[model samples]
Target: MVSPQVTNLAIILVMMQVSKQVPFDNPDVLLGVRALYILSNLIILGIYLYIQGKINKKRDMTTLKYVEPAPVGSGEEPRPVTTTVMEYDKQQLRQLIKTQMMGVGMMGVMHLYFKYTNPLLIQSIIPLKSALEGNLVKIHLFGKPAVGDLQRPFKAPQGLFGMGQGAVKSDKASVENAEKNWRGGVKEE
Candidate 1:
């Protein structure tokens, strides 16, 4: 659909061109004047809406009335809010925003980070991380360590201990012995 401004612009250009081409004695100037008058009315309406729209912000009853009652008053009335309800609403808003930003209690990101990046920690970990990694490597076709994937196998140590030194010894072990080690059995000499 053609907008009012565009229509006004076209009328102005038409009038300018017509005025230049037609003599002052030409009868067709009346037609051009009529077009200019129509365009002026459109311009006036556009300006009225653009300038007065803020004060004219009337709530559309057709859209809002079915869902929520028109905030209980005309624009002139000062809507009163109870302090308790106000505070409760504020708290709810704060909680909603906090949870939205922080996520489902940070578990979404924390779990992913822990899963992907097996970085060092101070806690004592399993006793036989090496043996476990070795068994994974032994059985695995690529001979890569475990802790990553079956094919690529993670470079990160599966356990919290030895900074991956354990996976080295475990890799050389026979499959039966490796299996026992992986089950957390005692490492016999």
Candidate 2:
């Protein structure tokens, strides 16, 4: 299967092509697309809120331990991360929410401030699609087991053009090493 990044790119390109055909200069059409954009944002927000509720209900408190990979070319040792599933899930949700907010802010600037209307239509569809395909949505909303790709500390997202590596170091030995190093006063950088 194609990666989500690739799929998202394809969708954006297709939408851009479609957007060109839209009569944004026309007042009625622009109004309709703006309404659609608002509706889409609300729907995604509702889905995230529902998933948040589900996560709170489950309250999975299982201990989750892993070694967080150091930043690229930082010459730093990976740091050991220890957190409960509930905490981890909440952090992930916060990240998602933050991302959604940023996107909305950007769209607002483009559509409302800059008077650019093409993105209003494209943004509407892409975000909803992304929310539905999100890892949390798959696990909590769709009831997929948290294994494989859906596993905790999800493999760091592959970088653009696949140049960036995840190297999360979640294996038992790596985790232990990181923990020992952390406790031994080994400076991270």
Candidate 3:
């Protein structure tokens, strides 16, 4: 499977080529792109809202435990997390919404403040696409069985180059080690 970074790069490249074909200098065309951007953001937000509704309705309360790896180069030990499936999914969904909002805010700055039109057109589609492709949507929205990679306490996403292990550790030894370290002040290597 192609990495998400590669897929995103390909999408951006194609969008850039398409952007070059559009006449951003034309006020009418620019207005249309701006409208498209707003509409796409609204659609993405609507999808997330729908997923939020689903999560609220189902409210799976299965307990989940994992060790969240510490930040790279921070010299901090991994921390244990204990949460219900419902809560974990909520946190995941909240993060997705937060990231989308941040992107929209930055894009608003770039397009409105910087008066950049091409990115408005390009970004108009990216978030919507991401929202549709997101794992939470696959499980909650599309009703895919959350087994394997979609399992609860979903594995941390691989880095762009697949350079590191997943940050969330569910294995018994890892969780026990993190719990011990957290409770007993054991220094993590």
TM-score of each: 0.18, 0.92, 0.93
Q: Which stretches of candidate 2 lie over 4 Å from their true place?
A: 183-189
C-alpha lDDT values of all predictions: 0.32, 0.88, 0.87
- Indicate which candidate wins on lDDT: 2
- Model 2 weakest 10-residue run by lDDT: 180-189
lDDT for each residue of candidate 1 in 43-128, tens digit (9 for 90 to 100) = 43343333233213422122110011123334322212223322322333344345333432343354346531111110001111
Better of 1 and 3 by lDDT: 3
CA displacement after TM-score superposition, residue 5 of candidate 3 (Å): 2.0
- lDDT of the structure predicted as candidate 2: 0.88
Model 2, range 1-189, lDDT digits (tens) per residue? 888888889989999999999988888998899999999999989988998899899999999999987787888777899999989999999999999999999998987789898888889988999898889999999999999999997877776587775467668898888887874665456
**lDDT string, candidate 3, 61-145, tens digits:** 8888899988888787789998898898899999998999899999989988998889997798778877887889999888999
Residue 47 lDDT (model 1)? 34
Looking at candidate 1, what is the lDDT of residue 95? 44
